[model samples]
Target: MTNDLLGRHRAVLPDWLALYYEEPLELTHGEGRHVWDAQGNRYLDFFGGILTTMTAHALPEVTKAVSEQAGRIIHSSTLYLNRPMVELAERIAQLSGIPDARVFFTTSGTEANDTALLLATAYRRSNTILAMRNSYHGRSFSAVGITGNSGWSPTSLSPLQTLYVHGGVRTRGPFASLSDEAYIAACVEDLRDLLGHTRAPAALIAEPVQGVGGFTAPPDGLYAAFREVLHERGILWIADEVQTGWGRTGEHFWGWQAHGRNGPPDIMTFAKGIGNGMSIGGVVARSEIMNCLDSNSISTFGGTQITMAAGLANLNYLLEHDLQGNARRVGGLLIERLRAVAAQVPAVREVRGRGLMIGIEITKPGTDEADPRTAAAVLEAAREGGLLIGKGGGHNTSSLRVAPPLSLNVAEAEEGAAILENALRSVR
Candidate 1:
């Protein structure tokens, strides 16, 4: 049955859409942190559908909200006044930390970021964009243009001239050997030098933690330092928080807050996890920047009623349960446990991330070169042991991505870790 489905999927779907496992399991249902395949084999879900299931699988609150809203109306478009959309927008605006903030909804992180590019270029009247090295923003043409990871970006043709910046990844770079303080200074100096050689760019867009380039991040205040230089040059700073927003990083509600000394960004784009599993994405900016577009615009399916309702419910549940704090406490423990497990495995190069978003980089034993084959072996072994994780990185997807739902408990974390440890050992 799985083989038949795989054949049909390959026939109908784009080749670029990658699936996991040698024989991918058809997940038919989920409950809490567990999901069951079509063959009724259950596994502990650590990837959370690429971290989109922020709260939990089959969350009752989100399900109820969606069903109730659907019974009344699923979508009324952005043409009519959407109460749910307005409510969700208001809540997000207050939490956004942008003064006099306005929110415009989209359906995916790609769309939100594309809208952000539109705003920044129009506001600053420049087509040049500064993007971080080894960062993954989205898959759209404009988003791909800004993306620095060569493996993920399929094209060089772009409307905007994008210049890749340094300091997104602290390890495996020219400045990797430097101390944290020295590294920040070197990156700042590099930014200043780049600015001198190029036309005034509209904005410097970056992820606080590079998601698809692996869960790598700069020092806490690196962005703050860069913000000072960009601010002086009238270059807007846009934080792409698609993977780092909504308290996923235990210590900060938003990833940019790790650099809070710099104040809020000129604009912020978000998408994944906001609606739990529902499609919800948007851009938040000060009214001045958001209103810069004189021409009228509307997203046909951006702020539809159903997705907004889901967002509202999910956000409420996340806040009410204090999932951020949970992520901090639980994620900290999970990382430590995984670190202990990784220490025993020679192929495990490094384990890095904050809160629930963690990455284990697999490498050749006692060497720095990435070992993607080992990573793939571990992924398959974990699945066979009833654990589901993810793999990503710029180095041919050599990192195991262990981002569970924010509601992950200690027992589940320990269980998942044990399975992962066994998988690593088996692979070795």
Candidate 2:
């Protein structure tokens, strides 16, 4: 059955739409932290559909809200007052930390970021943009234009004049050997130099933690320093929080808070966890930037009743249960355990990230060269051992990404870590 379905999928889907494993497992159903493949094989879900499952699988509150909202009205084109949309927007705006915030909903992170680009360009009257090295915004044409990772970015054509900045990844770069303070200084200097060569950019868009760049992050306060420079030039700061938002990073409610010295970003884009499994994405900005558009615009399916209902319920459950605290506690232990395991493995180049968004970079034994084969082998082995993880990196996709549900408990953390350890050993 799985083989037949795979054939059908290959025939129908674009070849560029990649799937996990050599033989991809068809996940049919899920419960809290666990999912069953089409053939009845159960695996502990650590990736959570690329970290989209925020609370847990089949969370009752979100499920109830979605079901109830669907029963009444699933969608109404953004022509009328949407109570759920308004409520969710109010909550997100208040939580966004931007003064006089306005929220615009989209169907995906790509759309959210595209909207942000539109706002920034229109407001600032420039198509020039600054994005960090090893950063990924989204997959849309506009979003892809700003992406800096060569592996994920398939084209050089872009609507925006994008300047790739330094300091998104701190592990392997010209300034990787520097201390945190020196690295930040070097990046700031680099940004200053880059700005000298180009027209003033409309905005500098960055992910607080570079999600597709193997969960890599600049040192704390790096962005704050850059923000100082950008602010001086009246350039906007946009944080792409698609994967790092909603307390996944633990210490901060928003990933940008790690660089909070300059207050919130001028604009923020989010998706992939806000509505749990529901498709909900949005952009938040001060009204000055958000209201820059002079013409009428609406995302037909954005802020629909069902998705907003799920988002509201999911956000409520996340805050009520303090999932951020859970992410901190459990993810702290999990990273420690994985670090211990990695210390014994030469292929494990580095273990990094905050909270549940951890990454294990795979390299050739005793060398810094990325080992994508070993990473792929470990992924396959882990799946065989009843664990599901993800892989991403700027260097040939050689990093193991471990982002469990924020509600992950200690026992599951331990279990996943043990399985990952065995998988690493098998690959070695």
Candidate 3:
């Protein structure tokens, strides 16, 4: 009955529910990099559903696969075997570069993370999992538990059982700096202290480039150290690639690789855009961990007929189109444009990130204003100008997150960057 009412009021949000409002524009349809509003106005989708729609809307390849797969078999109960499921898992393992990695599918990024937590606990039996402060893992119970934010405290802290290393995502502090090797050492020490003092060590979970936590990407060796530490304690490492996986990053398909980790995680999870907005989530565990799970088990959802086909289509499209190379090429253009913008914009402090994931830190005049208000203004200004971008960070300062389709071309990059430049000039 509740769902029926929601279905009836498709575009309406209840007043009692907290909502985020920018200006006003209704989405009509989309092609590659453009979206049409209700009134037929077009907007450049730089944000791309907060970095979820990697292949853009309605690609021929993805749609065709979905159509064919749907006709044959949309879904089967977990009790049944399906080719799409096996193929998806097999591709993820081969693509992930982890020897003999295996996958378990879920419905969302958070669900994948939750499954990673379970797999970690079952294999390592460690009591604690470590994540970065202000990191956005997911909103679900266990996913939110590992998330290093006060928002979920008093709610999940008592039962969730997770530890946070360092108080900031952008910098290793109670220490200091980005682009520093010492910060990595400090974080490792912090993890050691937390583990030694707590005696609860199961897994270390992190986003290679923290999307919501100020868009910070720590040193390349950060994961390697964590992997080493966890292994020493008979614990496992988990990489939550919910946002950074696939070809979005450009140079590599997954964020863990960008950091130059020596080995693979015991469990790695994926969701967003694995099927180009289709309802698919997955966890790729090392063979040892995966083998321990009961073979008869399954990753099931009640209504899941369509997701399988959509996921296969999305994966095929990514492979055929060479979106990974596109990410690198256009991502390079974006970085150069951002650096140019920083040279001009006084409020802009630093522009950091790799591949398609980028962030601009807005600092206070004297103290380097990371003003959230300013960030919000930029976001709204961009929206009003028909460029869709989003913000991530713990502070009030705006930490801009730019993740577009992996297939975005150089022309789109120029248009998006130019629009952003004009918006910056308009902002106070």
lDDT leader: 2
| lDDT head-to-head 2 vs 3, winner | 2
Q: After best superposition, candidate 3 residue 3: deviation in angstroms? A: 21
lDDT of each: 0.94, 0.95, 0.75
Which ranges of candidate 1 are over 4 A from the true structure? none
Candidate 1 structure lDDT: 0.94
Q: Write the per-residue lDDT of candidate 1 for residues 264-306, one digit (tens) a residue.
A: 9999999989999899999999999999999988889999999
Query: Residues 197-239, candidate 3, lDDT per residue (tens digit)?
Result: 8866677788887877767876677778777877788777778
Cα miss at 345, model 1 (Å)?
A: 1.1
Candidate 1: worst-modelled 10 consecutive residues by lDDT: 16-25
Go through the candidates in order and give the clash count of each. 0, 0, 13
Instruction: State TM-scores per candidate.
Output: 0.99, 0.99, 0.91
User: Tens-digit lDDT track for model 2 on 225-312?
Assistant: 9999999999999999999999999999999999999899999999999989889999999999999999998779999999999999
Model 1 clash pairs are: none
